[model samples]
Target: MGELFNRFHATRRNRRRFWLSILIFSSTVLFLFLVFFVKRHEQKSLSYSQVEPDSCVRLHEVSGVYRIRSERNRGRIWFATAQGLYELDTLRNQWQRFGPDQGLGSDKVYDVAFIDEIPWAVTRRGCNRYNAKRGRFEMVAPGSKLDRAPLILIEEMEPEGVFFGVDGGELYRLASLQAKPERIPIPDGNDDARITCLKKIGEMLYIGIENGWLYAYDPRNGSFHRYVFGRPLSPHAYLWDVVLFKGNLWVATSENGLYRQEQTGEDTLKPVKGFPAKGAFAFALEEDGFWCGTPFGLWRYHARQDAWIQFVHPREKQPTDFQVLTLFNEKDRLWFGSLENGCGYLNKRNLEWVTAFPSLSRPNAAALAADDSLVWVGFGYQGGFTNAYSSDALQKIKAYEASDDILEQSIQCFTLSNHRLFYGGYEGFGYLNMATGEYDHYSARRFPEIADITDIAVSPSQGLYYLAGAFGVVAYYADKDSLASFSETRRYRTTALYAEGDTLWAGTLSHGVLVIDRKSGQLLARMDGVSSRVMGLFGRPDNPDLLLATKEKGCYRLQKSTLRMESVDIPDKVLPGGCQQYENNIMTAKGMGNLFWVGTRFRGAVVYDENIRQWKRVTSQQGLLGNQIRAFAQSDRYIWIGTYGGVTRFHKPYLSRLLDIVL
Candidate 1:
């Protein structure tokens, strides 16, 4: 009985141990299965979150004026700036801007015309009509005949008709934008000639061609006749403007000053006396006198006195030498639009000139970088630098000429890492420690071959820094304070560099991309599937693959594991489904979460949605400063765009999602 009881107890203990082992094994297996399932689902259904256009897109611009127009009463002024179209509230002294979201056809507005008190504009793309009731510029349909050509000039004709001229010197009359335009014949019959200006008086229409040709048309007779200036004007002279003032016809030329003739008597235009010899580019008619906008200054002519008075403010440090491009007159107020400085307003009663929308002399922004606290923009060549704490206000950062450590004044590229701001230029590379306000510089003397530092990349984990320029690629050891050659291919010019973990990718001007081992500076591989001129490279935040930007070839994705490259087809309304022809010259690229942003040479920036597998392009049509993008940088809430015109900060909530993963 004792042996049997002991055997029963041993059997029960063995059974319990077996069940315990089975439970442990099953639990482990279930946990592993759940992990695998979740990861797989996450990868397959990766969310490239999107923000609403209203809440996501914001533009920060340093107001650089392009043109200006005023109302008949001069109570309100509209400024066409490098940034966008702005309406100045004279009473409040503030500006209200209109952009793509507000219905602008394009943010880069070249000229504006008022038809029936409604503002219509000519942009880089075509013509747009402002619909005040809808609060947006209604874009003309792409199928319209006008869309086939670029419209450069727009003017309102008599009896509720609009007249517009295309770059090909084709003039069309539209009774209403909804209706098809009626083609008007030119005297020269040269469809390739560029139309520069147009004016109307009584039953006659005056047309100015860029090739120093002037024509007069009679709407009643439907006849075109060329106007002779009687003087030998250069064949290549540009006819800037034409105006009908006080029973006289006035014409402005780019090379040969100004000319005037009687409205219906003179067969030839006579040179206007007391005019600037260099030429007048713009003209405005006044009740008592006429205003002429010249390259050097503004000239006011009194018809009664037959005398000229010039307005200049060079001694007062004002924009006296501003190349006036256009002028508007309202009662006692004279508004002058400049090619460089912003618009100038003169109150004839007080003889006071107030320049509105003051801007940078040269705002050719080339490099951009931003953090949550500040945004930095570097200009091209000798353009200098500027920064802004708030995107709404950009202020110039003074040059550190007082410090001998500061070598290059013009910045070409910028990178911000670990509170250190790194800048590269034609001369060398330098860094500014943000926390300590300490600055240091390095010159080509230390790295003789690197005469110009085109790009800089940092690998914090390895404490390594890489520089790419005319000399190819070079690596620097922070601990040893020494530099070594990463690539000896000096013949191939390097344009950009990106560092990821133990790998460094260099984009060459004509040799595609080079992959190097950061640890040993070994050439691991070469990617040449795309065009030879690789403009930029960006690493995937979640994967080892890279997104490559190329010139004229669009973008491509390089798979790290397979070493296979495939072109990314960007679809557009004008392109075929598989075509990559819409703005293929990509300049820069950045990745945020599963979304990729590509900056192009002419088409602005494109945003790719990985989840939807679609792309949306943002340009001047979409409120960007300009289409020519130079560089891009991102912060927690904004994507900073460096453009040829200026820097634009795009507010993106998706960046916060990326920060959540990183932090």
Candidate 2:
């Protein structure tokens, strides 16, 4: 009886053990399957920021307008309208604008002129004189309350001084309209006529009046020469503007194009075939010719052929599109200020249309890095995507499958370990495979939940991945099948994370920085008492410290849990995105280098020089299809820049430099 009872007990024990084993195996399989399924799903549904237009140019006011007075060029047209002032570069297909925002003044610019080497701008407040050599503008008006019109025609006149034709066909002068312009009236025969335009030649000031009458006032004698055209032309027609070119007086009328008379004695006014009938209003002097502004467009008077060459508004021939409001010549190009479309540029040689400036859809990106054949980009609030760039012969590949994950993923930092690429985003920690475009499961649903992963670091010694999120830091060991968690005294938002040697560094928005010992998983040091919240962190080259770029505090270096402030200053510079450490060098992958590069959200890439401590900016000036930098990677010697526009390469210097360091 005892032997039979013992046998039954042993049999029950064996059955229990077998059932337990089956349960354990099934649970393991289910966990692995869930992780795989989540990762696979994430790789398929990726999306990016929606592209849209933000603002428009305000009409009725000019933004930028001025005369470029340089050594080779004199009195080139420069103008500022509400849209912005632009310099017409005829050869190139663009316009250049300058101001206080671009560096100018607070008053609205109305007119610009040059006298000898001095330049002056007329504003509603007063006349501003400029010393171009010193790049300074100051109000030089002798008084206050100046007129709204440009009346001076001298080669070297004060900003506040102006000359004009009187109503009586005589010449009058006003000194410093800003201070209350008082007219120095010159007596004339026709006292009821209105003044039109004025010009100064040699020692005489020529004035055009409303009755088609012309008068030349000698500054020496204060006398006038009443020159009137014969009855063949309408005597009541008002004259527009006048100029002296090649020792001849060129008269512009309201309806008639231009009439020329020689400077020699007994010269007669004759109609020139070169001038167009009607439309021509303002006159701007150029290097080789004089530019005329009309309602249709700008016209250049070629002296050799004695003909007017019109450069109409640049467009696709939609007659009702944009209307030419004003025109100026800057450098060598003709700037046509428009009513609807901001502005237009005309090429000098071919007189063809170039392009227009458009608003940016997405905020620019910062630093971009690639490792293990995958690219990582750091952005804000909600982070972005990843892409792949192969250097050899420009192998273009998307870093993360766009259709794999949710469209809007907040990724701040990313790193690579062995064959896995990890990302620290807003929601959770995630990884991707190097060989196949596959992702590992990401979750914040586990116990001690971790949401908003700020930075990521990998332990080369333990082959473990460290993720820093809003709550604290978590370490995941794939090989050992172990996971450890570390919590701070209080919940804090992590900003940047990195690992150097055996120490791990995590930066936070409000708490400054946290340094941890890898083996013990213990907090070693806390870098607090900083001016602003930390935005990025990077490991210095060949140094044990990390670099932190703050929200408003420029940049600082942290070594051995010690803080070292940096002296670098960015001028009119705003740093975007976050930072990353790779191969002993620190980098900012967001839109901060050179000028910040734009790319795909998943894998925005940035190229920079450690020695120079400068970032690469992808700009239209550099021939990049677009500025959004998504992913970046280095293969052998080549560096690839993956962007929403497409993948670009910087091979020669970049590839050659890496070869030296690697081999």
Candidate 3:
């Protein structure tokens, strides 16, 4: 009996060891899975890069209005925009913004409708309804069927619900905010199923789909009738907008222009004659007339004379209010939203003055320069305009006169040193006396070789200004007021410039950096092995390695001691579905403290901390107007980023928490 007891104890001990081995194996597998998930999900290498809202302000107001509606008794005006929904208190004149933070399904809200004074929005994320008391949006849909919802229309008749259209030709109705979405069958006609606009005419519902097709549905009969615009539509043709005016139908096509149907007409839509633009974007109905928003501007149709009156933003031209996208009118106040300039309404008789002003908008911020007291934004392309604003309030300081000759050209690059703002662009290079607020511009006539300047650098060591562009590298001595051209780099296409000691680094299109002596204006040696297409360069007196930014290629650490360039490894991603097109590009880079901030053409920013040798990436998801970054300007407390869409300012103190993720 003793022997048997001992044997049983031994067996039990063995069994315990087996179970422990199994547990250890399972834990190992689980740990591996978690590691893979975190690396894949968050795109984490060293740390993460999502920042809180307080850290950044996307000042560009990415507000492209798609639809505008007024809440009559509520004294509220609702606008569906590209970024989010905006609610304006017409009485109190206050604006309340509703975005993803406010529980919105998505930021891309295309249409918003109010039923029973409650706002219902259709966004790329799906259907959402506002809970006013809670001040947030709640999702109201079955699963994710309403995902990619773009157009919404209210139903006043029986069923008393809202009809929303999804991108995949699927339409759903919500009988009540709390109820599930019911799918409504839609007739197929166009190849593209994405719905663009929706309008309700009596019991018949008009649905405009992409691909230039319109469908009219009668709820009573459960039937759909398809109508088409004249054939041979452009390859990019699509129905942008539709409206009912004077018992007739009017529709706008993306590329084929505007179309209209007579009160008693055929299934085919005829092109609107005398319409200036080939593409009309939006329409708003008035008492007897209708307003058409087009690429040319806003046109108001007069019933009496059957003519159209044009109204555009006075100070801007083609790139300004010329491309009117959305319009809405309330009595004498005509609200209009352009492609860039947020949204504003025009009073009666405001149309005439628009003719005089011609509505050319402020030039887009191509290059940015800032100091303690002021920030100067320079525009290029359609003639340059230097706008100076107070750093405290960001209010424009009308310091330059309209007739200034410098304002007539585009400013491609700017170099601010010693209160002298040196600008270079299509005309050549010029200097604006920031202290005196005086404009002293130089045209191509001043120096023919400096024309079409791409980049300019000021040599603090030698106090000489160097130019690199289409005409190649040139030297200008401010003290002597002399210009010298380097014949060796004369035909070479230079892109960027950096001054180090007495040597000037000029990045070329394909030849690499042209290291030249600032005093003699002579080319030293071409630094090869780096990118043939270098963009921007950042260096410091203490740092041994110079950070070289290149187009499409990641940055490199060029050792000034050895004159060798080495590539740095950039992770494939930092977030899920993020930076798919990231080529590890560092289009422009600037260094401050231990951090180097670089902007990409696609991604908003990528920050590197030298202390930890780690990096973080940020994009539009982190509050950027647009991802195509062009320029950057930094102050003590704020860092400004200029993109094709607009400028973004980062509050440095608050931003540190998000960017300081490495160590």
Cα lDDT computed for each candidate against the true fold: 0.69, 0.51, 0.69
Which is better, 1 or 3, measured by TM-score?
A: 3
TM-score ranking, best first? 3, 1, 2
Candidate 2 local lDDT, residue 350: 75
- Those runs of model 1 whose alpha carbons end farther than 4 Å from true positions after fitting are 1-67, 71-74, 81-83, 262-264, 315-321, 358-637, 641-645, 651-663
Off by over 4 Å in 2: 1-77, 80-108, 115-118, 131-136, 142-182, 186-196, 210-213, 231-238, 262-270, 273-275, 282-292, 298-313, 316-345, 354-663
Question: Per-residue alpha-carbon lDDT of model 1 for 1-663, expressed as tens digits?
Answer: 999999999999999999999999999999999999998667534431232334334444423354567666657777775545777667666566665556665556766777878787777667777887877777764567676356777777676477888876688888775687788777666566888877676667778897678887776667887878878787788888888777677889988888888555676987876675577788887777788888777888888998889877443355445677778777777877776556767888988887654333245667777887767666657434444343433333332331245435666787788787787777777777767887777777776756677788888667677888887887767668677776555656787787776777888887788887877777887776655567667776467677776766777788776778888777764223322455546666666556677777676777776656677666654345678877787777667777776666655644334322220
TM-score of each: 0.51, 0.37, 0.56
Q: Give me the runs in candidate 3 sitting further than 4 Å from their true place.
A: 1-51, 61-63, 66-335, 338-365, 382-404, 460-463, 480-482, 573-586, 661-663
lDDT score at residue 26, model 1, on the 0-100 scale: 100
lDDT of 2 by residue, 1-663 (tens): 999999999999999999999999999999999999987665432211111101101111232322222222533335544432334443443334333322233324544555444555544334456656665565554443233333222223343346443323433345543344445454565554666656566666776766577777675555778665633356566666677776677777766656767454434677776466453455667656687755455677878776778665645366434445445455545555555554546667677764333111112223245643434443334235443433231122443322457322566555666676676655667667666856665667663445776666666566788777667787888777455777552366666666777777777777888777877777887878564656556664365545565554545655563465453433223225332212111223332222222232232333334445554433322323344444443434434443444334444353234223211
Give me the displacement of residue 132 in model 3, in angstroms.
22
| Per-model C-alpha RMSD | 22.6, 26.3, 13.5
* lDDT, residue 295, candidate 3: 74
